[model samples]
Every structure is written in C-alpha cells, then in structure tokens.
Target: MTADSILNVRWRKASASDPFDNCVEVARLEDGEVGVRNSRFPSGPALVFTRDEMVAFIDGVKKGEFDGMTV
Candidate 1:
C-alpha cells in the first residue's frame, strides 16, 4: 500500500492520541496499512506499518514496555 491510496482515507485520531509537538498525524489506510506523517509537512514522507505491526506497537504501549513497566 502507498500514500497515494491513503490520500482519500478518512483519517481519524487515535482515541488515546496526544497532540504532536512534531505535528505528526496518523491515519488507517484502506489496505489495512497505517500511515504516519508530519502534519506540518503535508508532502513529507510517511512511515507505513502493517495492521499486525500496528497492533503489536499499541499493545506494547498499553503494557508500558518502553517505560520499564509491564502490565
């Protein structure tokens, strides 16, 4: 999946989303890919992740794996 296919996607902010000091925005692409990019830079490059990868990352956040905490 490519950003071109994601352009028309209805982007929704994550329920637990926080404002981006770096102007970042995330959207779920139609092809089940996740698109992350800097809102400040509309034409900026985006990082794409598969649905499973995104879910794993979210699970890690909920478990605080990066903060030295396990839930």
Candidate 2:
C-alpha cells in the first residue's frame, strides 16, 4: 500500500529504540504484508514487505549480516 493509505494503521518500534524515537516503526498490514516506516517521518513514504521477505531480513539481522552497515 502507499504511504498515505497506511497512515492510520498502528505502528510499533522495537523496545531497543531510544526515548528520542529515532527508529523505524513496523506494522502488520490488513493485507498480511509488513509495513515499515521511519518514526521520524511518519507522514513520509513506507515500504511494504511480504512475510517471507520480512522473515529473511530478520534472520539476516540475527545473523549479523548487516552489522557492517551500522555504526
């Protein structure tokens, strides 16, 4: 869905996020896909991912595959 379409959905951020809300928020869309957006840009664009794609990304994260990209 487009960013404007999912604006009313409930979004949540990880518990690890700082109090400043500088993090990505995620939500389960009605269509069963996962929606992701930057907490700092709530009205901006969002990315929608299928369940499998989201699972693979989370798995890669757990394996530290994207560690090098972070600070």
Candidate 3:
C-alpha cells in the first residue's frame, strides 16, 4: 500500500524501543498484509509483506539467521 494510505492506520513499535523513538513501526492492514515503516519517517515509503513472508522473516530473526551480517 502507498504511504499515504496507511497514515491513519494504528502503527505500533516494539516494546523494547528506546525513549527517543528510534525504531520502525508495524501494523496490520485491512487486506491482511503487514505494513512496516521507519518510525523516524512516518510519511516515508512503506513496505508491504505477505503474512507467510513476515512469519518466515520473524522466525529467522528468532533464530538469528542474519547474525552473520551483524558481526
């Protein structure tokens, strides 16, 4: 969905986010897809991902599948 389209949606940030609000926000769209955008850029471009794709990504995160890149 376009960035403007989700402007009114309820976006949420991770519970662990710092007080400075430096984190991404996420929300579930009407079409069941997930919306993700940078908290620092509320009106910037957003990326839409399917449920399954998000699940896979989340699982990978839990398993630290992308840890190699961070090291």
Candidate 4:
C-alpha cells in the first residue's frame, strides 16, 4: 500500500534505536497487515506485509537467521 494511505497509523520504532533515529518503524494497518518504513523518512514509501509474513520474519529474526546480514 502507499505510504500516504497509512500515515494516520501510529508508527513505532524499537526503544533501543540509536539517537540518530536511523531505524525502521512499524505500524499495524487497519486491515491486519503490518506496515514497515524508515524512521529517517517518515513520509517515504512503506512495505506492507501480511500477518503471517510478519510472524515468519519475526521468528527468523529471533532465531538469528539474519545475523550474517550485518557487517
């Protein structure tokens, strides 16, 4: 969905985010989808994902499946 479509939603970032606000923010869309966008660009585009997709992604994160992605 377009970023403008979800602007009314409450976007939140991780509490552990750096002071520079260089992190992604997430919000729960009205249709049960999850919206992800860059905290540094609140008015930028966003990626929409289904509930199940979010669950899988979060699960993978907890399992360290993306640990190698960082330098």
Candidate 5:
C-alpha cells in the first residue's frame, strides 16, 4: 500500500536517524500489520508486513544476521 493511503497513523523513525531524515519509517496498521516506508519519501509506496513477519525480521536484526551488508 501507499504510505499516504494509510491515514491516521503515526510513522516513526530511528532515534539515530540523520538530521536530513535519511532512514526508514514504520507504523502500525489498523489491521495489525506493519507499514514500512522511506522517510525521504513519505508519499511513496509502503511495504505491508504481517505481525509475524515483522517479528521475525526484528528478531533477525537483533541477531545481527544482516550485519556487514551495508558496507
């Protein structure tokens, strides 16, 4: 879904985001899913993920499974 289409939701970014807001934002959707979008493109398309999917992704993140990819 498009980020702008999911009205009335608060999108949050990481606390360590740059001053220019170069980071992704996430919001809890009405249907218990999660919406993720780029902070630089608020009106851009958002990827909707189920709660379980989100949980798995977060778990992987905590485990550093995606580490070193940015480099």
Candidate 6:
C-alpha cells in the first residue's frame, strides 16, 4: 500500500529509555514496508522505507552508522 493508504494507520512507539518520553513511533505497512515519524509530530511528514532498506538501516544503527552525527 502507499503512504496515503496508510495515512490513517495507527502507530506504536518503539521504546523509551528515559521516563521523560523522547521516542519515535513506527507504523508497519501492509506492503512489507514501514513508516517512521516523530512521536510528537503525529500529523507531520514521515519517511517511508522498503523492508530491505529498513533492515539495512537497523543494521547500520547496530553498527553505529550515525555515530557522531548530529541533527
């Protein structure tokens, strides 16, 4: 399905290490892809990734691909 198709989909947060709550939520698409958006910006723009891209991104996270990278 496309992003518009999943526009009304519900999302769940991954997890939170701090009790204060600064985390992101993810929505799993029916087409095997995924959508990620800031938990605070529920209605804002989201990034869509294919299953393989998501997996690779997760792997990169595990390997610190964003190490020292600041937003």
Clashes of each: 0, 0, 0, 0, 0, 0
lDDT of 3 at 41: 80
Question: Which candidate has the highest TM-score of all?
Answer: 5
Q: Candidate 3 or 5, higher TM-score?
A: 5
Reference-based lDDT, residue 36, model 2? 94
Q: Residue 55 in candidate 4 has what lDDT?
A: 100
RMSD (Cα, Å) of model 4: 1.1
TM-score of each: 0.66, 0.87, 0.84, 0.91, 0.96, 0.71
Q: Write the per-residue lDDT of candidate 2 for residues 1-71, one digit (tens) a residue.
A: 45667845789899999988799999988988999998888778899999999999999999999999978
* Top lDDT model: 5
Query: What are the per-residue Cα lDDT tens digits for candidate 6 across 17-39?
Result: 35554667788877778888766
Task: Give the winner by TM-score: 4 or 6.
Answer: 4
lDDT: the better of candidates 3 and 4:
4
lDDT over C-alpha atoms for residue 30 of model 6: 72
Model 5 agreement with the true structure over 42-64: per-residue lDDT tens digits? 99999999999999999999999
Evaluate residue 20 in candidate 6 and report its C-alpha lDDT on the 0 to 100 scale: 51
- Candidate 2 vs 3: which has more lDDT: 2
Instruction: Output the lDDT of residue 59, model 6.
Output: 97
lDDT of 4 by residue, 1-71 (tens): 56676856899899999999899899999899999998878778899999999999999999999999976
Tell me the deviation in Å of residue 51 in model 5: 0.4
In model 4, state the lDDT of residue 49.
96
Give the TM-score comparing model 3 with the true structure, all chains together. Answer: 0.84
Cα displacement (Å) at residue 51, model 2: 0.7
What order do you get sorting by TM-score, best first? 5, 4, 2, 3, 6, 1
- Report how far residue 62 has shifted in candidate 3, in Å: 0.9
